[model samples]
Target: MNETENDYHGYTPMDYDEDSAADEAYQTCVSYIVEHAPIERDDTVVDVGTGTGIVALELASKCDRVLGRDIDDEWLRYAREKAAERGVENVSFDHGSFREPNVEEAVDVVVASYALYMAYDEGGEGTLRAAIEGISSLNPRHLVVADKMFFGPPEPRGGYETLPRMGTVANLLADTGFTLTDVEIVSGSAGVLVASRTSG
Candidate 1:
């Protein structure tokens, strides 16, 4: 398959029931965020590239409102339907990119699961900078990032490559004015990083 096809296939939603490993890792990441992040009642959150609303739905249960933004309209639609089916009224989904999110007001927390790394690899430093700038504009108190960690060179996958180490991610967050607070490595190679905005 070509690069485009590979990339598209990589992001194609999987059946959660069939993918036990992925599901477990996802749940672990969600639990880590809930325990470590500053997510609380009355807080508004934005889940960037929120595919199918897994993280968004989880946050909705804890926070007052959650907006799940993704570039895929199909995923956003599915997320909205899933929220409704689950009777989660505090969550909503929209079509947008993490580099240029569509949220208007300042949110209390921003969570990106396995999404920012794709942006970083696809667009390189420019996309990474854009993502940080966009998140900064929201003035969030906390940020949560979860992705696979590559100790060596990033290996090619379905459509993209793996991300750098947790240290690299921490430096990027620090460059964007966020202070690293916590990190958890799970499923062996996959990990989550939580950061808080530094006071000016």
Candidate 2:
């Protein structure tokens, strides 16, 4: 049992149940992405912000390989345990930011759920763009980002105010040369936006 530090929040995977609302939201978001991803058994997928590795593990069942990356490795450990318990051998984990992943190459599709909204700083827009570019640089067939979009001014939380509008992400993807192929919003839900790269 390895204990992770607080600075490594991304590594600390939150405990979730299949019956919980968060879990349900995660599944809903993932399902939409999977539907639009065009991933196959021979393709490789990467799930960013892969807390507990649920999305990654589930994806592995349908893809040839899957890598779940998080800032924290503690959650990754739990993901590994779940994978082991489920006998899912194709999924793995890494502790790092998608902005600067340590992988030697990019995978097929990048699934980022509720992660992009957390990307904020003085150069927030630039950071988000760079992160998207980093993923796009891998030449993946698809890039799926599920974020919390607000309709008005955002409330103060975790020292962040005025959350980035969902349109921001869509525009960023477009600025980075990604085509807006799909945009599906679940009524009465926070919302999950799916975008992808057009095949040349």
Candidate 3:
């Protein structure tokens, strides 16, 4: 393998199963997008924090094209291979950070899955601000964020007290000029928050 391929993030595409149960998580997220988005067949969608191209591949079928962006080159390679395996010609991957996406092309819809949370620390105040700005810079017609809020008792991985409440993020979105359009909680373990760009 080339050094570039090996030096990328630790993610190995082959390590992720295309048919894993986690795929249900992806599918659930996609369903939320199709439901809340004013998606059009001609729209070009961007899947920020796209891991293994799951959301990007799903969007490819519903949009004119789909681009998956991630900072990990290994994950990008894996995403490309997955796209190739599925013969999804309209889906592509780029090695970049969604927090500071570097793409010239504007998209119609931007979807950020669980990947957004990793960009922040406890409380996620700064992280949410950066995330909103990053998504806004894309100038997409809509922004969809799929994340989970921990409201349970304390645990080793940090519990509710260690994380920002969903309402905190909702307020952060408002402060950053995003209007909440829909909210959904899945399996009592995750919450999906969808919002649209609005003037500050």
The best candidate by TM-score is 1
Model 2, 49-146: lDDT tens per residue? 77777667767868889888777666678888989989988888887566765566657777777666556332477777777776667677777776
lDDT of 1 at 53: 79
Candidate 2 residue pairs in backbone clash: 10-72, 11-72, 11-73, 13-75
Q: Which candidate, 1 or 2, would have the higher lDDT against the true structure? A: 1
Q: Which pairs clash in the backbone of model 3?
A: none
Name the regions of candidate 2 deviating beyond 4 angstroms: 1-24, 121-123, 151-162, 187-189
lDDT of 2: 0.67
Query: What is the TM-score (0 to 1) of candidate 2?
Result: 0.80
Predicted model with the maximum lDDT: 1
Output the better candidate (1/2) by TM-score. 1
Predicted structure 3: lDDT: 0.69
Clash number for each model: 1, 4, 0
**Considering lDDT, where higher is better, how would the candidates rank from best to worst?**
1, 3, 2
lDDT of 3 at 127: 62
Residues 93-192 of candidate 3: C-alpha lDDT, one tens digit per residue: 8865655776778678888876666554432568667766777788886778776554344235444223445676677777767888878866344567
